[model samples]
Each structure stands twice: as structure tokens, then as C-alpha cells.
Target: MNCLKKTVLFTLLLLGISLSAQTVRKYSNEFMNIGVDAAAFGMANAVVASTSDVNAGYWNPAGLLKLEDNQISLMHAAYFANIASYDYAAFAMPLDKESVVAFSAIRFGVDDILNTTQLIDDQGNIDYNRISLFSTADYGFTFSYARALPLDGLNVGVNAKVIRRIIGDFASSWGFGLDAALQFETKSDWQFGVMARDITTTFNAWNINEEKFAEISGAVEGQNQELPETTEITLPKLQLGVAKKWVFHYDFSLLTEVDFNFRFAETNDVFSSSFASMTPAAGVEFGYIDLVFVRVGAGNFQNITQLDGSDSVGFQPNIGVGFKYKGIQVDYALTDIGDQSAALYSNVFSLKLDWSLFR
Candidate 1:
């Protein structure tokens, strides 16, 4: 927080904004919105209203205020036939009786891509030695803080993030954004949550190294292409969710949740679209005395009957199970990607550690 540091931060922020202006597009960074962790994804990301763990910082930061203990969580996912991987790590600590803070990081990467170039000889034969490998990756770091409001059962929170994207070694970009959220609960176990992501709109500045492109082109003939330098902008999105809990049979309980998502883009004017593009999601969880859990959910349903020729209305499904014991928890989930040609399934595994047990 010194003057020099502040100056550097401001410079970077301005650079990102200026570069991203050239190539800004609606929802340019959708990957950041993809839910992480098996439990959240398995519940169709409906936990926004009722989340109470470390992952809450990512889904609904206000939910972090519900935690009474320090905890850490890690998750790894295999996506799209193992060609890509996603990982998340988070740590949450209570600042006081009514306030909490958390730090989290996420990474998504695709590796082992073959870098092919044209052969120098005219025999039309490919040179195996000329082929190399490269990878693309996206990274994000989030710092969040939450506190209970003076109103009973009400909490508010905020998240600040730094983002970086890399493509092979030739291109890279930097970005930053802010998020705000609120959560409310009633005596009847009814909960509501609202979140605004990228409220100020995130900007990314792309820096392409033309010299690297030239070196690659020089090695291979007629295989070079010019690279475009530009920036990307992500518009603000709103998420609203509600949940209810039903308790019965001594230690058994059923939790149900529903969520609505809205995207605000220059192309999709909110006044005109009304609710046409709102995506609705629902999920259910069956829990036994906080020891074992089963979850199932589906969401992002669209008819597309009149808009497109396809009459298919299949919704993506997710299933997961979890076990908890002595402050240690493990979870696994399988999600359908809804793509016929690509990998049919994506898998996620997560582990959690609650330090309160040791205390």
C-alpha cells in the first residue's frame, strides 16, 4: 500500500483498460463465471443462497460470514476428455465473531498441444523433430471479505481479483475486477442471495510479441500469420437465488434451491429483452446428519424451438456424493457437458479441512 506500489497498480489498471478497449466483447471472460468445486457444480450452482463454506467466496461472498471456523479446501477437475484441467484452492479465516476473510486461486489449462510448422524440403515429408509442444492457461486470484450487517440474518461482502491469461509463450494479458454480494436468511430457513460480478466491468490488455511470431515464421516457409493485438471486456452479470430447508426423520434433511441468472450486454438491452434470456436453475440435496450427502441438479434450460430449427430441449445434468467425518470432508461429482461430439463427461474431486477440529 505504499506510494510506489499504488502508482504501479494504477499504471497496470490503465494499461489493461486501454488495451481491452480494442477487442472488448460481451462476456469475454466466461471461464471466470464457471462454478468450481464438486458440491457447487453438482447442485447446479444453486448454493449461492445457502453456501457456508470456503467456496462461498467464489459463489456468494456474503455466505462467508456464516462460517465459525477456519477452513481450507482444494479441488481438481478433469474436463473435456482430459485434454484440459481446472484446479481451485481456498482458505477462509474468521477475523472476529461477525466478520470473515478468504483467499482463493483458480487455474485452467490445456497442455501438450502439438506445434506444427511447414517442412523446408519440397518432398512433402513432415519433419518430426520440427514439431514442439505448447500450452494455454488462465489464472485468477481473489481476496474477499464479509461481515454481518446490523440487520439480523443479513450479510454483505466484496471480492477483488487479479487475472492473467497466457497462450503458448507468444501472447499474454492482465486484468482486474470487483464483485459484490448479499445474503439474507429468515427464521423459517428460507434464504435469498444476490450477486453482481464485474460490477465495474472487467478489462483485459493483450500484449502480442510480434518478434516471436517472426522467429517461428522464419523457421518455416508459408506458414506464418499476423497476430492481432487487442483488449477484451467482460460485462456485469447478476445472479439471484433462493433456498429452503426441510428437516424430518430425526437427522435427515432435504435442501432445495433455485437460481436465476441475467446477463447485461450492449447487444442485449435489459429493457427490451425483459426475461427472455434469463436462465433458470434448480437443485436438491439429501443429507443425513451432516455425515453423508447426495446431490442432483439441472439448469441452463432453453427451448430454442422458434429461434432455431432444433427442437431438442435437453438440460445438463449433474450428480455428486460427499462424506464428512471429524471436520474432514471429501466430495466427487460427474457432470454432463451436453456435447455429443466432444467428451460426454467432466469429473470433479474436492477435499476440505476444518481447523476448528484441531482447536
Candidate 2:
């Protein structure tokens, strides 16, 4: 740790704070309170702009585009608060001279819920609140193909995905979606990127053949009870971001980068929100001769209610690190909202072990 490097990193921290001033005076919500898959949520989710690492696959599949070789990654986070847990495993390999192929499986779901429904006959009867954990799960498998077209320094890629969700005693649904990403890196160190996801609205429905719900109709039971009509909402999400990576001015082993993102989508059980945006995130990594990395950053819209004493909330600080080995990669991240927001969160960890045949 050099003094000069620390000073520069501190300066960037100040700038991040200034950006925060402008982020306020907007809005807030609950799904935003629901912690994401990992502590990696620790940072402003600076993961997408990250390069040469497998975690990038989750944040931005296009990240695999800059890889010098083929690789695989696995990640899991123990969600302490809810039955929810996050797990993902993926593989990325170059298919041809200008194409890359990737495969991955992702899962996140609530465990069993207390099945406390009182039994009743066609005749109206009353029952006490029951207690038993019901079953539920959601998993999706995806394949992504990316290419670097030789078009005057312009790089582009496309990724297609399939998603599935299963509700206990309810109908399950599956659908397809696609994403596109484009980037540019010049003779200088400046780099720029743009991406769009969930181009198609993915849908799911409950109470079909697999799970049947008997409708109970009794004027005494209150209103025409239609076992919660199977609803439809768009999972179609969209986000756009730009990044800039700066070479170290003095510390040759270190490099720094900053990114800003704007997100838009409808509400879901996953994250409650009308919209989300992260602007001007900054971080610096003290690299140990290109073998290891120690990084820190701040800023991302967070629910202030998540914190205890503070009546204020929206975006917080994040810290993370990574270790890379031949055919093996590991990553970890941490987020701090403040002491007022005492609810501790789980850590997000991911690993990727891949092999390339025939050199």
C-alpha cells in the first residue's frame, strides 16, 4: 500500500460522494430491500464492468467477450435471512476464430412455507391457522454465444437465455429471452460499452395440471373466492451502462475503473421497484503483479429502511476481492449500509474451474 495510491483512491471516493448528492431527491421500494444473491451486492455491483473473471457472467454475459481463453465459474451464497439462496455455475469457451460459447445454470428461491390451511367440505366450515412448510423452487439453464466482429474497432455479442420458476401446488412456467452488448476500446485506455437484457417478456402461471387448486365458493366464505387468479407480469428488464478504465499513474501493478448504470423494469417478488439506477461508481485495485486483486468501491441505490437508526437510505459502500489461478478463479464481495441498518447480510462467493483442450 503506497501513500500516493491511497491519496488517489481517496480523491475518487470524494467524487463518488458528490455523485451521491445528485442521486437523492428521487424514490425508493422493498424488492430493493431484499438483498441480492451475494454480499458482492457489497459494492455498487461494479461486477459487470469487471473483465477476465467469471463473476462477470452474472452481471454481464458480454464480459466473457474480453477473455483471452476459455473458462468456467461456480458461485453460491447462503442467504441467512430468508429461505432464499443463490447458486450459479457456468462455462465459457471460444467456439471459433471470432465466436465464444457459454453455458450456465442459475437458481434462487424461498424454501418451504407453513401449509396452515384448515380443511373444509362443500358446506361452509371454519379452520384454525395451520403450520407446515410448503415447497417452492426456481431454476434456469442458459446458453450464450458471443462474437467479436471485425468491424472498424467495434465489438459486439448476443446472448440467449431460458428461465423457469416452480411454485408449490401451483402451476410452473418457462420462457425465453435475449440480450445484446456492444463495446469499444481504442489505442488509448478509454473503453465504452452498452447492453440490453430481457428483450422479451418472460411469463409464468400457477394452478394448472401439475398442481390443481380446488375453488371454494360460499357466500358465507366472503365474496366469490377465486383462489388468487393466476396473474401475469413482465419479467422483461432493461439496463444501460458505460465504463472507463484508467491505467495507474505511478503504481504499475494497479489499475482503476469507474462505471455508471441506469436500470428500468416493473415490480416483482424478487426486487420491488419502479426503477433503479447507479451512477458514477469508482474503485481501485492494488494488484500483486497481476496474480491477485484487492478492490473497493461505493454507491448503488439501496433502501434506507434497511438500516436501523437512520431515516435516510439509498445506495451504500461496497468492498470486494478476487484471486485467479490457471483454470481456476475465485471472488468475494461485501456491502456496508451502516450501523443504523443492523440487519447483517450473507456473503456471496463464486468459483470457476475450467479446462481448455489442445492449447
Candidate 3:
């Protein structure tokens, strides 16, 4: 096929994947799993135990209780050769000495997609003017709450999520889910956390535009004959993390963390079984007087089958840096460095501001 034909085919494939909703899809609501915050991305998403900022609203809400002041955060990243954009924003504050609350929003979208179903007229004459443009997007809004427990150094949190997904003028879906998390700190400075996502089994109900479907039905021969399934379900997943920070010379510090992500159904994770799968991730950060920071992480371990039918281990590596001053912080992360994994790499940037910055 020609380059233009290839591009069109690829675009349609993406739309098809997004519109294929089922009752129990393994990767339903996957955009939410892409994560937020350059710092977390830098660490390959191993910050659940040590995340204590506004970004924690999406990572591990229990960590929100550690916020000492009201804060706001924003992040943006581009993927798939800039064909898609991912954006995030969040606000967090202490409701009281023992409790905290946060609000977060995320969007991942592909804009200006060409709609070519009408490119050819009834006379079989191709007309470029017949093409139109549309977009496909996914949005998630989370309301998170965290509270300190009566037990010293213990915290618990919960998140209520509203999900919306749109495929231009063709199909749309709305979903809701719940997440629960816990965090604990020890006198030895060890931090531990556990997060349960989609704990209540998230569900999405899709609404397809019959007219649009009919228009495309004839565009591709013997394809899309029937309407897609209207219901999509997302199963529960878990993440466990442990971290510790050590200070030296009263002006330097290092933080190390490890995380285990588990999905109930087996796939190609580092460790897989019929019942569950696990991927291990590790990250480290070195800081000088809490002002300059450097981070490195590795994760997304998978077993890939080579062309020769041999299984090979593959993983993603990430690196990032940050600077903080006067209640403001900026962070940058390069994920999937060196294209070591099957997925594309991305450059992520994020900003954080403490309310005190205005004072």
C-alpha cells in the first residue's frame, strides 16, 4: 500500500481499537494507567509509597495526607509521534490537621483525525473536499480523600472516578470506578503503600451514533456490519510499594523505592500465571539540600517473543531531573529511553506550585 493508504489504515485501526468495547476488556480505561507527573514517570511509576504531593491524588491518595500546604500541579506529554497528547492538572489541600482532599483531571486525545468515509462520491469520483476532521479523546476526573488514622504513622485514602471517552461523532462512553489505598511509615523511616484500582469493577456504557455507523458501513466492504458491544468493564488491579530516604552530610539525600504491580489476569508481565501477573519496578533519586534532584528508574518488564520463537526479556528505562525553590518545582522526565521497549518514548514535563508561593 502507498504511504497515504498506510496512514489512513493506521488511523482507522486506532479508532477500531478504541471503539471495540466488551464486557470484560483487559485494558479498559488504559489511559488512566499512563500515569501523571514527570517525577513519577521519571521513577517509572514507583512513587506510590513516597509520593506526598498533589500528584498523589492519582498515584496513592493516602500520600495526600502528607501535604503541608495547598498545592497545584500540571503536566503534559505527547505520545505516538505527537499524534496524541496527554494532559493533567490537580489541586490538593489539607481539609484539617488529620484529613486532606484533592481533585484531579486527565485527558488523552488525538485531534484533527481525517474522516474519509465520504471521500468518494456515488459516481466513484474521489473528492478531497469530502473529507472532514474529528477527534477521539478520553477523560478522567478523580475526587480523592485521605485521612490519618488513630494509629501513629498510618493513613488511608479513597478515590471516586468519573470517566468519559469519545470517538469523534461516532461513539461515546461514560464510566465510574473506585480506588482505595493505604500508607504507613515506620520509625526507621521506611514507607509502605498499597493501592487498589477499580476496586468496585469499573463499567463503561457506550452510545453509538447509528447514522455515523451506517455511513461507514459501506465505506469498508464486509466490515463493521453490526454495532459494537455497548458495555465495557475494567477489572481490579493492585500496586504495592516500599521506599526509604536517607540523609547524609546534612545537605545531601538519597531515596530508593521498589514497586510491584499486579493485574488479575495473566499477560506478558515479568511473572505471569493464569490467575495473576506481576511487574517489578525500581527507582532512585539523589538530591542536594532538597533543591536539585536527579532520578533514574526501570520497569515494565515483559517477555517478548522474537522472530525466531525465543522468549527475550524486555524492560523500559526512564530518567528525570527536577529543581525546586521558593515553593515552586519543575520536573522533566524522558521515558522509555533508548527505545529499549516496544513502546514509543516520550518527554514529560510537570510543574508544581505551593499556595504559599503567592504570599
lDDT of every model, 2 decimals? 0.78, 0.51, 0.91
Cα deviation in Å at residue 35, candidate 1? 0.7
* Candidate number achieving the greatest lDDT relative to the actual structure: 3
RMSD of each candidate relative to the true structure: 8.5, 11.9, 2.0
Please write out the lDDT profile of model 2 over residues 172-203, one tens digit for every residue. Answer: 55555676766566666555556565555334
lDDT of 1 by residue, 1-359 (tens): 33333334323332333334466566566668878779888887888898988999999999999887999999999775566789999999999978999999999877665555333335877777865666667899999999999999999999998989886766788999999999999998899999999998887887877775555545445543555556777878888999999988779989999998777643322122643246678889999998999999887654434345655455667889999999999998888745521226888999999987777
Top-TM-score structure, candidate number? 3
Give me the runs in candidate 3 sitting further than 4 Å from their true place: 1-10, 13-19
Which of 1 and 2 is ahead in TM-score? 1
What C-alpha lDDT, on a 0 to 100 scale, does residue 38 get in candidate 3?
96
Candidate 3 global CA lDDT score: 0.91
Pairs of colliding residues, candidate 3: none
lDDT of 3 by residue, 193-213 (tens): 999999999989998898887
TM-scores, one per candidate: 0.84, 0.70, 0.96
Show the lowest summed lDDT stretch of 10 residues, model 1: 267-276
Task: State the weakest 10-residue window (summed lDDT) of model 3.
Answer: 1-10
- TM-score of decoy 3: 0.96
- Deviation of model 1 at 11, angstroms: 33
Model 1 residue 131 distance off true place after TM-score fit, in angstroms = 1.5
TM-score of 1: 0.84
